[model samples]
Target: MSAPAAPASRADWPEIRTGIAADVHAFAVDDPGPLRLADLDWAGAPRLSGHSDGDAALHAICDALLSAAGLGDMGEHFGVDRPEHAGRRSADFLAATLRMVRDAGWSVMHVAVQVVTRRPRIAPRRREAEARLTELVGAPVSFAATTTDGLGALGEGDGLLAQAVATLVRPGDPARPA
Candidate 1:
């Protein structure tokens, strides 16, 4: 919820900006099922995802980048019903988002993402998650892990939530190159 720092005025320092995007999925619970967040190795936990290939991490990051670029959100760009994305890798969505931003004359500074869950403890997969995300944006990005801490419906462990922030370098900045 922190405000994005001024971009044009803070040229000396990397211009700071914040964009938020969130998503939730009603993952059908099943033991020995596929856990579909980046094809992640789930360490033998319950599976929860609504999409054909349920990837909470990729979905959240896609929205973040689109929001930061002042582009319409995910639904506006990628339709959930489209056959192109059917059984598609969530990573592909993130890659497409990067192409959109670059075409708009901007370079990615970094992205920060949060994956929310109450089971199986996601801390172990944090590094692998970030590496994959960084590749999506074509730059270094941050992926952080946090739990609902038993605070809300998510805290009670009903579903999962992912939130992300994307910072972009505007086009034509002398100090930045796309």
Candidate 2:
């Protein structure tokens, strides 16, 4: 006659957290060549202006991951003031962010990002972008894009905007029963 163990309380369950973040970058009026987004290059597309490669999607994902892991935002670690990060690739930011998260005992479970823009539509490259992001974070990443109904600067083709949500879990924690 053995009794089953009591169900674990929510507080005792494995830690799972979600973080949201958004980033925007204006089109680079000066530089002309290709645009970098989600770690992929869009040839003949206008580039976004930023201290880095100006990949808004990747930047938002980094911020979201950091937020979920209770780490500081991207600017704190890779701000414009950081001379070394100037013109750095967005994928580099992602790698560094992942390291910070792992160091904090958290692993990214998933990330979803949405891009808002009027040009260089994302549909054609969604798969490529997701694959690149998943490879970089070692987690599943989803991407989508939309327009602002032609109402604002983004919709008018002035810049790119990206928003992301990330889910994180503490490794080695007991999984919750379904």
Candidate with maximal lDDT: 2
In order of appearance, the predictions have TM-scores of: 0.79, 0.90
lDDT of each: 0.72, 0.89
Residue 172, candidate 1: Cα error in Å is: 3.5
The list of candidate 2 runs beyond 4 A from truth reads 1-7, 171-178
Positional deviation of 94 in candidate 1, in angstroms?
Answer: 0.9
lDDT by residue for model 2 (1-178), tens: 8998654665445678999999999999678858888888887568989998999999999999999988989989999998999989998898989999998989789999999988787888899989988998899999999999999898788998999999999733445543
Which pairs, if any, clash in model 1? 27-49
Off by over 4 Å in 1: 1-17, 173-178
Q: Tell me the number of clashing residue pairs for each predicted model.
A: 1, 0
lDDT of 1 by residue, 44-148 (tens): 555666544667767877888888778888777777777676767777777788898789767788777777878657678778877876766677877776786
